[model samples]
Structures are given as structure tokens and as C-alpha cells.
Target: MTSDLDTLFSDAFERANNTTKKFAPDVQLRLYAYYKQATKGDNFSYNNEDNLKNAFKFNAWIQLKGMDENEAKENYIKLVNSILK
Candidate 1:
């Protein structure tokens, strides 16, 4: 990845920090929680009380599907790099 990844992650992080102002409070919370779950590991299971019972998994699918695959991969790598630092 290039320096652009750092920039992209920084920009996304800032928007995420202000998610409440940029989106509905519930949407912000959902995004925040789902994002944490999505990037936490290589394994993702949507078979849960909140996701299955509440049908939030569909929204989760949508959120992830909208991401640019390559960019998201770079962001994930960049995020892990920052953590290691």
C-alpha cells in the first residue's frame, strides 16, 4: 500500500469519530459496532441474537458490500499496522 492508505484510514477514522453528527444516532452506533466486529478477525459469523433475531445482518451485509474491496483490504492492513506500532 502507498501513503494513500494512511490518508484514507485517517479520513475514515475522523468521520467515524463524528458518526453521530454525520448520521442518525442509531445508524452511527450500528456502524461503529459492526465495523469493530467486521475488522476484528479473519472469521465472521452473523449467526447471533442481534444479527439473526433483529435481522441486522442484512444491514451488515449492505455496509460491507458497499466497501471497495481493495481499499478496505488496505485499510485493514493499515489499521493492523497502527496497532502493532
Candidate 2:
């Protein structure tokens, strides 16, 4: 079941990322954060001041810090659906 879900989430994630239709900034951040959380979990980190973009991404990812991968994946899919409507 988990594997199936992972596969499903992967497809959804790809769709979200690869869509030529542009998303609003807020929606994009949600997608970015959810994607990072789903894929990287606790291993995702950005501790350096190398780039402001990275800092924003780090903050966004941290906002969803407590979410597990499956939950994040679910949210990712939901977010995509909402934006599509």
C-alpha cells in the first residue's frame, strides 16, 4: 500500500512541477515545501547564507517540519488539485 502511494505521489509531484501553466507565488511555495518534505524529510537542510532563494526554500520546508512523508505527499496532491480548479 505504501509503495502504491509513493508511486501515486511521485506522478502527482511530477505533474505539479512539470506543468507549463504557471502557479501563483503562494501556491508555488506550498508545492516546493511539500515536495521537499516528501522527498527529503529531516535530511533536507540549508544552514548557509549562500543564497536567498535557498533560505526561502529552507524556511518553507521547515514550516511543514512535523509532517511525515506520506502526509506531505497527500498534501501535495491536494494542493495541486486546488490550484487546478
Best candidate according to TM-score: 2
Model 2 is weakest, by summed lDDT over 10 consecutive residues, at 41-50
Give the TM-scores of the predictions, in the order they appear. Answer: 0.36, 0.84
How does candidate 2 score on lDDT? 0.83
TM-score of 2: 0.84
- What are the per-residue Cα lDDT tens digits for candidate 2 across 1-85? 5687788788787787688899887788889999889888867667795688777778888999879988998999888877765
Q: Write the per-residue lDDT of candidate 1 for residues 1-85, one digit (tens) a residue.
A: 5466556655666555654444554554454444444454324445446644345544543456545544554655454344333
Q: After superposition, how far is residue 58 of candidate 2 from its true place, in Å?
A: 0.6
RMSD of each: 8.5, 1.9
How much is 75 displaced in model 1, in angstroms?
11
What C-alpha lDDT values do all the predictions have?
0.49, 0.83
In candidate 2, residue 41 scores what lDDT? 86
Residue-level lDDT for 34 in candidate 2:
91
Give the 10-residue window scoring lowest on summed lDDT in candidate 1. 33-42
